[model samples]
Target: MERSHVPVLPAEIVEFLKPDTTNAGPVVDCTLGEGGHSALLLEHAPDSRLIGVDADATMIERARYFLGPRASQVEFVCAWYDDFWLSYTGARPHRVLFDLGISTFHLAGSGRGFTFREDEPLDMRLSDSVMSAAELLSGISQEDLADIIYVFGEERYSRRIAAAIVRARSSGSLRTTGDLVETVASAVPAAYRRGRISPATRTFQALRIAVNAELERLRMALPRALAALSPDRGRMAVITFHSLEDRLVKWAFRAAAGDEAAVGRSAVTAKHSTASKFAPKLIDTVAMPEGERITVLTRRPVVPSHEEVAGNPASRSAKLRVVEKTRIEESW
Candidate 1:
């Protein structure tokens, strides 16, 4: 399978990123799943340097091959975006792109069990993490497992599915993607199995999220990336395929902006409080100045165009949200 994973929302990303056109600094492709977005940015901004990061070693290798000569312009790292953000203390980057969720290649053919259609091992770790889907199923309590499916995957049949998984595991290890699919199928009503969507889809999604710690990692990474962004000189773009990931990105951006407001008020108070010796104490601060923060570019997230969705079914669910860091004085 030629890794049918086409980059989602390429034109929208390029338009918002505006790479190097304004003499912006370096750009970071935080997800860099096959370097599709990176290659486009490099083509648009010949002078800009690229930092590409992915947790999967296989993705980095594939990116190198696919990007070829353009790959030379990028500094590739095989690490999660969270760790990359912490380790990267260099000059603030001009832009960052985060495409969350599994790439088409992984879902279609990686044999990592991203899809229930494949009979691969139940291993959904994006990185070489300690936990695999099988291990998670084997270890977690049924209640916790059901909660994960309910909260993360939003599956209606979470209780039944989780119970089925526990029952199956008790007999023999539920060790493969086939095992999980069958377990979920058995739990749902026969009518559900023949519904418009697969009965097992949400269960697989929940397990993948659990195995990869995707949401938690994104929550941790977004702040650090914002902190490293140049005031008014940087932008971050995130493409989320589902509601769970989109919710995290939306709230994180709002929270960061809110913190920025609080910090400014504190700054003014500190100056006046000096005489009283109160010191306008900073309780806890992860606040970046308003100028050095994120400004949501899309009041409403940008979705794939009708034509694009028609052409690539995988892109149908994609929603792109962009935030640009503005100078503290600039009203976002």
Candidate 2:
């Protein structure tokens, strides 16, 4: 059975967007996923024509089916959000949305090894991703693999896990999801294996993120989304599930809003370059001074209510942040 997805902070997202007023203009859902968020957003935005973009073709088809009649209002594009937004030539959108979480569809239905409970192939690439987890594991050194798990996953037993992976791969026994999971389980302590979270969770996450270059695309997408916002007080809402993503959104919003503290701090790291193997490009690019033409709507990131989190465990780590465009430079 295909597990249904629930949009996190659905009510809050609609309220922040004020879709009724903005519905006369174009709206964009940069990460359409299974179209759960877009469906809700469009419910309140009757007149809004939508540009829904997603990297996975399967997701585009699933969203198309799930949307049903609402599909008429949306222009579904099977492309990465960054690519779609950067080259977008249509009318600027008044309301934009980005949900940074991976889709429940991928975890529950896609047989590409997104879930550890399955014994599928370790091919964790979305449509636009360059490499597969299997390919990455087969060639990566133990040291590099450890750094990826540590930096991207924040896994404390990353070194041990990487060592185990290296050993299994060398013996040609690390090709399947089960093999990787077993390797990770053997590396972590008994206590860690019995913790609230699965021991292999971080390893899988890190591998998926690295394979997809998720952070790199997000860094490029934010500025483009800001620029594509209509000059007439366009608003954008982004929902992030991890600290790495939230930090990027926060930094972009702060820099775009001209927050004094952000400006001062950004000066030193504005030109920071990635070192190719920097754990899936750990640092996000700071929005430059000229991009300072927006107002941060959410003073702080919004978390899911206890009730919501209880009902939908996936919402537990979600955080929402919104911003409105003050103006757009002609250069944009």
Candidate 3:
């Protein structure tokens, strides 16, 4: 079957990010899945350059093919976003975009065990990451595995599933995607399996996250990304597809914005209360002010429009939050 690729919230993302004004700067597409959003951004902002990053090498290649001549203007990096930050030593970008979680193509086509429907190898490494789902399940203790599934996937029957997996592995190694699926199916009651969603979904999601270290990587990468932003000019946008990711982004943005606000207040109070010759500068001249270093542009995350959702059902779960690095002086 031919796989279809669709960009989520194209019009809204373009509108939220007025890339047209950034004539000479670069925009980082942090999760450049299929390059659909990158293509639109490039089309809208003809003069702006692009730095596209993706953990999946196949998606990067697809972007290159679809983007064609515009591909020359884009710099594609096949690495996890966290590692990308570690290796990058360049000018701060004007805009950054992070579309978190699996893309439609990855869920539907990639034989990485992202979805339970396909019985492929039980591998779920987005990058050439050290761990695979099968390895993780086999190595971890049953209790620890249950904890991972419960916390990451919010699976209610985590203990049952974990016990089943352990039993299955003891008899014969759980090596394939089908083996894992069947294990999960057997753990849940037959009645529940006939419900709206498959019982295996959460277990699969949990395994995928653990295999790729998704949450851990996001936690480490966010601060580094904030630090890399150019004062006043840099803007970062993140789209999260799951609650765990959404919560992380929400808390990160709130913390940054709160810090910025506090710093600004401190500077104002210092300027009015003290008049000594040795009085420190109201704004930190050495660093971008916290206020300038980051601002939460979206009070609430932007969701796909009704039309967009209708056209692409996979995007129904997406939530976009944006942060801008302003011109004031304080640490991020």
Model 1 CA deviation exceeding 4 Å by range: 1-3, 21-24, 259-286, 290-293, 330-332
Q: Tens digit of lDDT per residue, candidate 3, span 1-332?
A: 33357878787778766574643567889898888889888888777789999998988987888888889889999999999987888777878888888787787878887888888888888877568877787788988788777767778898999999999999995878888888998999998788788899898888887788787778667767877776756788888887777766776666566544333222112222224221122321123335465678888889988888888888988999988876765457
Candidate 2 clashing pairs, residues 3+ apart or interchain:
none
Stretches > 4 Å off in candidate 2: 1-3, 20-24, 263-276, 279-292, 328-332
lDDT score, candidate 2, position 153: 80
- Tens digit per residue, CA lDDT, model 2, 1-332: 34367888988988887564643668889888889888988898676788889999998888999898999999999898888877888887889999985888788888989889899999888884577888888788888898788766878888899999998888888889999999999999999999998899999998988888887788778878887787577899999888777877887778667665653232112332234265333333445335336888899999999999999999999999999876556673
- The residue-by-residue lDDT of candidate 1 on 1-332, one tens digit each, is 14457888888888988686664568988998888889988989887889999999999988888888998889999998988998887778888899988788898768888998889998898887559887788788988888778756778888999999999999995878898889899999999999999899999888887788776677678778877877756788889988767766766666566644333222112213223221222222445654465667787889999999998898999998887777756446
lDDT of 2: 0.81
lDDT of 2 at 119: 95
The global C-alpha lDDT for each of the candidates, from Candidate 1 onward, is 0.79, 0.81, 0.77
For candidate 3, list the clashing residue pairs, or say none: 288-330, 289-329, 289-330, 290-330, 292-326
Deviating ranges (above 4 Å) for candidate 3: 1-3, 20-23, 259-291, 329-332
Clashes of each: 3, 0, 5
Best by TM-score: 2
RMSD of 2: 4.0
